[model samples]
Target: MTGFEGKTVVLTGAAGGIGRDLARAYAGRGAAVLLTDLSGEAGEALARELNEAGGSASFFPADLAQPEAAGLIMEAAVRTFGRIDILINNAGFGIWKPPLELSVDEWDAVLNVNLRGTFLCSREAAKVMKRQAQGGAIVNIASTRAAQSEPNSEAYAASKGGIVAITHALALSLGADRIRVNAISPGWIDNGKFGELRPEDHAQHPAGRVGRTADIARACFYLTDPDNDFVTGINLTVDGGMTRKMIYEE
Candidate 1:
């Protein structure tokens, strides 16, 4: 938080949910935030709100599934803020269907947005970070489904698992350049209605509650913090202990 002053953070899928909270958290901590998402209306509105409230912010509308999207985003961020210090790959969608029922188009869509997009963005940012004296951080937003999953979630699981693998791979490749890369696997984060929850929902986790956007946002900050330079290539699970619990069906 203290070190983020004047830093520039590029956050994808920042129009809503965890990405939106991340944009706010980084900006609130004194970072200039570049918010990108396919939803231009909402993304632009959030950028305006942040700027009006005295945070340096801008919105770049993009569909990360495209091959050129990532490069364009990084270029715009540099043009606006001069440099990129942190990159958060949070643009993704899930598809749940029986393996036999899933279509190739659906599978390709998820993979392109979730995995390929992350890779493209990280590659572009790393190139820029390598040229600078001060290196940077990249945090990929994976899901707990990568390690544990329910039926009919093959596409989502594969994409997230790829994220974990790519995180370590990038870390090893970029370490010499001082660019740290890591991944966060979140479980049961309620980005929907927060007030409409039952006691059983909170009781299901050993942490005694479901995850919030702030939980992931704080985790992002922790991984990207200059003080935690030694932490990289690790998949930090912010799942409230649910992934480690064993539950037997009644």
Candidate 2:
């Protein structure tokens, strides 16, 4: 945990459930965290909370849909923390509708933020990390939907699938620079409604419950840990074994 002491992390989509916890995890571990999101209010509040608790944290408002946002975000991080040691792409949204009704605009919106944003941010961070002697780590927050689908998830699935593809490709390209790239595909992570989940909901998962933000946070720590440098160019599924179980009606 203290391994992150004195490190700098840039995290996107940091106002939401998973993103918020991810921000805390990094800040709590001694990383000077730059939290970015569309919600400036939330981002600022979280940053304030972390700083009040004696952790180094700051907030930057951004809309990944904008082509210029990535560069600005990376700049803000470097300006605040002096260097980029970790980048977490955790910002994404989905537009669910019948595939026939899913307009090109909707699809574009999803890809722009989920897939394109991931790529742009990684590229910008890599530019900085490459200059540093130790290099850095990038963890893209993909989803289980990248591989499995429920219904009417074409755009969402496509974006996540693209994340996985770019993850390995970036890994291969950045290996020589000592920058490790990886992806985490989370399955059914309960944001804040765990109390409302029914018995069957927990039973359905092979792990006996829905996943928490902490689960993905732990995975992030593991992947970015310098000791685990051997781990790269892979997608680690953090689902509660839901992807492994075969579901069928009796």
Candidate 3:
């Protein structure tokens, strides 16, 4: 139960579908977490809910698209928790657009948040984790589109593809410092009622429903455990076998 006790995690996009789940899951497991998101109110409310439930969390609102936002959130987490042992690059943007239909600005925006944000957060986390006598872990949330993509997914697919590359590169770069890095690509996340969808949205996943926050959360917990010293530079696909299914089921 205390696998993560006393550990501090900095999670970006903490107000979004998967992000919110991650914040609660980590806090529930006794991790002190800093939740960063573009929505100040939502981030704060989520943190408040966790704290009220006996978990530890604080909101640090920041937009990953901004150049300074990633560093700012890292600094805030360290200031609030004394140190950060986990970094979840969970904030990202997905704009489905064909090559001709997609705008340059839109492409840039998506890449900046999805790709650049991951880079920025990893860089900052690497710096702090290096100082710790004990090392840390980093989990980057990508999409299943990186493997077998769909139409109008140029920007998003590219961003996620870049994520796998970065995971390998950073794993090699940070292994010397005892920091491990990995990525998870979630497919058809059936995040129920995110914004306005009904519970039926959960049926959208091939696993008889959409992906659960626990699905990804479990992976994150496994990869970050103190005993998990040998696992690194891996890209796990927790998409309910959707990506591997060749036939469309009824």
Model 3 misplaced regions, further than 4 Å: 193-208, 248-250
Residues 1-250, model 3: lDDT tens digits: 2478999999988897888898888988999999998966888899889999998898988888898888898899889999999999998878876789999999999999999999999999899999999989999998888888778989999999999889989999999999999999888664654446556655545666667788899989988887888999999999877777776668
Count of residue pairs whose backbone atoms collide, per candidate: 0, 0, 1
Better of 2 and 3 by TM-score: 2
- TM-scores, all candidates, are 0.98, 0.98, 0.92
lDDT of 2 by residue, 79-195 (tens): 998999999999999999999999999999999999999999999999999999999999999999999998999999999999999999999999999999999999999989999
Worst 10 residues of 2 by lDDT: 1-10
Error of 2 at 187 (Å): 0.3
Off by more than 4 A, model 2: none
What TM-score would candidate 1 get against the native? 0.98
Give candidate 1 misplaced runs (Cα > 4 Å).
none
lDDT of 1 by residue, 82-163 (tens): 9999999999999999999999999999999999999999999998889878899999999999999899999999999999
lDDT of 1 at 66: 90
lDDT for each candidate structure: 0.94, 0.95, 0.88
**Model 2 clash pairs?**
none
